[model samples]
Target: MAPMGIRLSPLGVAVFCLLGVGVFYHLYAGVISSRIATFRQKKTVDLRELLALSIEASVQGGREVKRIREDDSLQEKTKGKTKEGASEKLTLGDLNSHRKMFYLFKNTYPFLQVNSEEHDSSDGEATIWTPNIPVDVLNKVPASQMVPSESVTVWIDPLDATQEYTENLPKYVTTMVCVAVDGEPVIGVIHKPFTGHTAWGFVGQGANVAPRESYNANNPKVIVSRSHSGKVKAFVQQAFGNSTEIIPAGGAGYKVLALLDPSDDEKPDVYIHVTYIKKWDICAGNAILKALGGHMTTLKGEEIDYSGSEGNPGGLLASVGMDHKKLVSRLPPWDQNK
Candidate 1:
């Protein structure tokens, strides 16, 4: 397992995340063009440039997502329902957003592997375009602390909370990107499209977030998904006592952000997922949480590995200002089939 207490640096996040995509039909359309291979002087490139591409892609793609919703062109399709009967869905938001991030990287590196939830990855066109390197980020996280390009995996979730979005709950929607090095997420950016708010962090560097204030370990307030609340609710009530407060919300990104919400009534001390979840759904939040000196792991307290594939079957438990293992040990082993 990776070490605990990894930090998130705001400067590090700005350098890497601020990720982008589609506003110009083609990959390099919107911004002034710059070649991304600044360090390919015989085969070595800086991690900062790749992160810049992600940031620009995420920013532009976020605008497209908000525009799609504003135009009422969701093109929604039923993906069945969650176990508790909430709708499972897909929309143009998911497809287009995935493509935006993919094109930004594939067009430049051509061979770089990016993990996503959508299936329309055909590599239709390749264009060489990327944002200029973020110098401010380099000044924060020097080269010595970063991993090589070959060891990185970028996980992008174009639109999270599709179900909430369809239900006219735009407040919960977000676009996210995570860069994991050697199976540990080193950087992440979570962009809320409707509000144009983006929060990002690079592990061990520090975060733009503040310490939590609403946690009462003896009677913690926890957040879980509206659709997947039964098991998680039971676990929290059991582990933290029946008096523990449980807040049901949508979107993994939203839940993770809530852990740092400044409002007393809105902030949740913990976020938990009771079943198998896709890597794209939780990877960015994990990276951000880790960067904040927090923990996000399975019920057994093992860290989630973000090296490819979509599913994590061990379940999840995340907290920002508390002992993650102490919380984990309080719960009895949960049945996966329950």
Candidate 2:
């Protein structure tokens, strides 16, 4: 009303300001969410590229080392004594040229801030860009139920099949795993260096390949680790009987992939491992298999808890399109304490 121009009361102006703030917040949140999704997708692709490059470099020729004992620094860091306090070892296999390739990839990305301590070779300048999105915001899981970031884990097996990789069997080698939140694997990425195939998924979000196979089977085709076959062979024989077709495979992730996408010659129905297997070996594969209507658990039928030390003391069993309880019943007695 002043000078015949539009005028607003103080309350009206306040209301307008609030509306403006609300719009900005909505827009900002959308942008952040988009960025996070893009970042994840990019990381998966980049990881596959790095693995491929490493494989090629190794083929060109490099010295191979084996059974190298962990130095004090590596042992202490792996034992959860460091500030990172993550109870998982970076690499389990012997230090070799392929493993060196892993270090090259890890140093190149450094997106995993948790591995900052291990990045001492990176000029002590690891860029830290930890995502702060609340769990409830990312998924349907409620924030109150979400585990703290410190407790939220990221399990990684940079080169899953070391024996296969060193032997020039690139088909069996893979760059495996990433991101488990609150002991539940939330994000997983598995890359086959030889095939240039990558499969990734997040919990609740269906995988690239949806579940379609039926679990009903008389004699299931089983996959056992080629390197660690003794215990698994016995367990498979006992659980599924000798009639079950046993196929020895290399990488844990590769075995899961075989179950996910079976070839004409080798159609895997179950993956059973009864010996000491690390968390990194299974987390990525577990996440993908779960997405494909499959289940992975301890032989005792308990869900594998990812919070503890790297070693899976109870052994691991994975089945595609089958009742977990029924599979558990078939197994011999399991003593987790052992």
Candidate 3:
């Protein structure tokens, strides 16, 4: 064996090593490409699954909101008030519900990016949320392509209508979840704890509920914030005529629901808010609107981008059955309203 051995020059050795490296790279790349092709099929959730998960999470959060309120354990307090006498309150319900949902999504996907309204979710709550995805909700979700985990941002408003919640108005309280994909709201789940009614919507997929048929879009019944009507009342009244019927309401979730309500007398034609509002306050509503062939945008009629800042500045107008552009065109500049 020693007598049969042969030696190679330095250049030959270098070429041989280079060839070996090229072969190894080709093999590794083939395996990786094969895995990449089957990744979603073998080991990932579809958009529908995430949508159902969101609905379940919202329902659980809503349950906590109602249970905490009924037990008289909410223990509400004024967190702070803006210079405009607009007070923001916080309750134990808010903290617990958010903690419940934050863990709910985190534990399930472990990769979702969640933007919550509550900033005090440092402590862990006794994880009471079950991973039960509602069968009805899952069945209703339309099948869709899977997105990369990092492209989705889940926005949570654990307790909407805090003031109304403190004031014993259960109808106005809601827990909301919005899943925005690549800066666009694609799934929305808004649950009213007091009513046990859940509304879920996906951008391309229609909602479970439908808008009423009897609505007169020309007359346009508008729903606005009860506490922060501010100059919005005058602005809406002027744009839609004096008889347009401006209904004061609480919570972005409630206002959006009012638009989708089937009741003839109660359902409003539009939801308009003329003030700087947080993204979590309206993201779910906006998705719900989009799902129903409706749309929500700045008072200036610009579509909102949810990937970046948390606050939406130029006010908002959400409408179904009416021309959003035409409606917004009628309104004056947002700055001039005040």
Candidate 4:
């Protein structure tokens, strides 16, 4: 006659509620983690494709030039425009690639609220940048330096080693990105599309090349730009002496990787470039090398300020597993006038 009812004791009810909450939390955490991983994987794929597209464009431009040279009629018709066309094609390809990557990052991480200020670009194109993720969110940077993520700047090198790419040295070309918080590199990503190899790192989190390989302390090998070795040659001789081997490499990013993963017969220990360089050219490599127990600074032993102008007039000196202070001490004082 009484209404059918089932009532559990307080203890039983509490146990049931606790179990439900635990299960829900587990599922939620799994989904969040999965989403983050998927986003990163997608970003890597997009970057690889961008690099491939840029390389293809460059190769095609070269072929077009060759065809023009081979055919007299074609050469005559394109006389004034041959050089211009090739340069424009490469430049346009790089610009388009940059735009694509910018959009991808913007769309994928909408929460970051990326925006481009007018001052960010001189060519009138939008300069894309996102509000920095908090230091705790990154969890890889020192809290003192990175807590105010608003000061962080994102540096992207759509295609590094432009000269190498034009010369058909695809292996040296790479797409690189770095996040610098308060003028210190906190994260970096470098992707070599030709080889389909990607390396990434964060400040305190170390790098993909954890437990970096050992190197010879006495004979420290140095890497310099293959195309611009003349200027560095004298400095290499002065700092490392005539005996220190100088390895000719194509891109800064590639050279940094070599410093981390040297050949069986050779062990690269330093990368020195004493000339005007752009922020994008070195940011990614700097971050990775720093994370891997190295240091990158100016010839005067000053750390780079990423937030300043794009041009790095101070020159760069990077060393792997070697005392950067000791290395700087070996070089003569830099003359700004020179």
> Distance (Å) between predicted and true CA of 8, model 3?
41
Tell me the spans in candidate 3 whose CA falls farther than 4 Å from its real position. 1-45, 83-85, 121-133, 142-144, 336-338
lDDT by residue (1-338, candidate 1, tens digit) is: 97798576998666555453333336564333334344442243445565566666777668878888999999999767655465679998877777777677667765456887766846543545645745655665556443466777888888889989888799889888888887888778888889887777778875556557647666678899888787677788888888888899999999999888786466788888888788888988898899888889988899889995778888889998888888998877787666
In angstroms, how far off is 318's CA in candidate 1? 0.4
lDDT of each: 0.77, 0.59, 0.82, 0.62
Q: Cα deviation of 231 in candidate 3 (Å)?
A: 2.1
TM-scores of the models, in the given order? 0.81, 0.61, 0.82, 0.63
How well is each residue in 1-338 modelled by candidate 2, as lDDT tens digits? 54787789999999999999999988798888878865663323222232233333233212222222222221212424312232433433323333443454344444432221122223332322232333323353223232333444555565566556545566776665545655776566677655566676656654555443554356788888875576567777887788778899888878888877745368777788776777878887888777666789988877877766776777788887877778888888866544
Model 2 error, position 303 (Å): 1.0
Q: List the pairs of residues colliding in candidate 3.
A: none
Q: Rank the candidates by TM-score, best first.
A: 3, 1, 4, 2
Q: For model 4, how does the per-residue alpha-carbon lDDT over 1-338 read when each residue is reduced to its tens digit?
A: 99989899999999999999999988798898878876654221222222222233223333333332234222111113211133212433244445544444444333322222101232332433333443333344333232433455667666666556655667787777776766787667777756666677676665556424676556677888776587788887887688878888888888878777744245577788877677778887888778877888988999998876776788789887777898888886776446
RMSD of each: 17.3, 13.5, 7.8, 14.9
Ranking by lDDT: 3, 1, 4, 2
Choose the strongest candidate by lDDT: 3
- lDDT digits (tens) for residues 55-94 of candidate 3: 8778888888989999999788888975356778999999
